[model samples]
Target: MSLTSVFNIAGTGMSAQSTRLNTISSNIANAETVSSSIDQTYRARHPVFATVFQNAQGGNNGSLFADKDQSGAGVQVMGIVEDQSSLMARYEPNHPAANEAGYVYYPNVNVVEEMADMISASRAFQTNVEMMNTAKQMMQRVLTLGQ
Candidate 1:
């Protein structure tokens, strides 16, 4: 793939990871949020991504044992989805959001999971940045060779 294409691919990766990190931050920020009902609870969100492929004619390998054709370009974000898992319920009778049964519902987000996701997303973003930087350096080196 061309150096420019490498930059594009890494850029997409960085963007995707940024979205992931944002979602995780939202989740963690709302981890302790209490709600009067299930419908009012904050939902955890995640970003979806898809691969961009080019036909073999353009240079895409499209093979089982090899890297796919990245020359065509990078990837794209499909969407962000909310996790639909069950929310947590706790018995806090004096709480403002407590139900008739003294149970208050909270978001299903777990602090531990959110922390892990944050770390993972941050690392992925850094990796993409490094990849882009490496690609830039390689391109600069190639120019020096020509001069």
Candidate 2:
């Protein structure tokens, strides 16, 4: 792996963590939201990620002997998926959003879980930033070696 590729790998990690943080924020924001129907209730969203492999030949050059042992290039966001867990149903007869049966459907989002996820994503983002900074420092040191 080249020194420059470190930046790409860390950049992708930061991007993925950003997406994760966004989803956690959304989940936390809707944790207490109540809906009149199950269909309208908010479902906790999570972002899926996948490893992006670098082209063995590099830069699209069709080399006869491509390096097959090359490691991962970066990470990519697959998609955001909604949780399939059941929504919370509460008996609030006087609530305006309650259904005919006096039941109000709450979002499936769990505040505690969302908060934990937020913390984890934030830590991951910080780690990626640190990795990028370290790579930059290493490159700078390399440049000074010949001086």
Evaluated against the true structure, the overall lDDT of model 1 is 0.81
Instruction: Compose the digit string of candidate 2's lDDT tens values, residues 24-127.
Output: 98888888899989998899999999988767325523434446544778999999999999989999999999999999999888788788888899999999
Instruction: Report RMSD (Å) for each prediction in the order shown.
Output: 3.5, 2.5
TM-score of 1: 0.85
- CA lDDT of each prediction against the hidden true structure: 0.81, 0.88
lDDT of 1 by residue, 35-138 (tens): 87888889888888887665533655444534732344566789999999999899999998898999998888888988988888899889989998998899
Q: Using lDDT, give the best candidate's number.
A: 2
Instruction: List the candidates' TM-scores in order.
Output: 0.85, 0.91
Clash totals for all candidate models: 1, 0
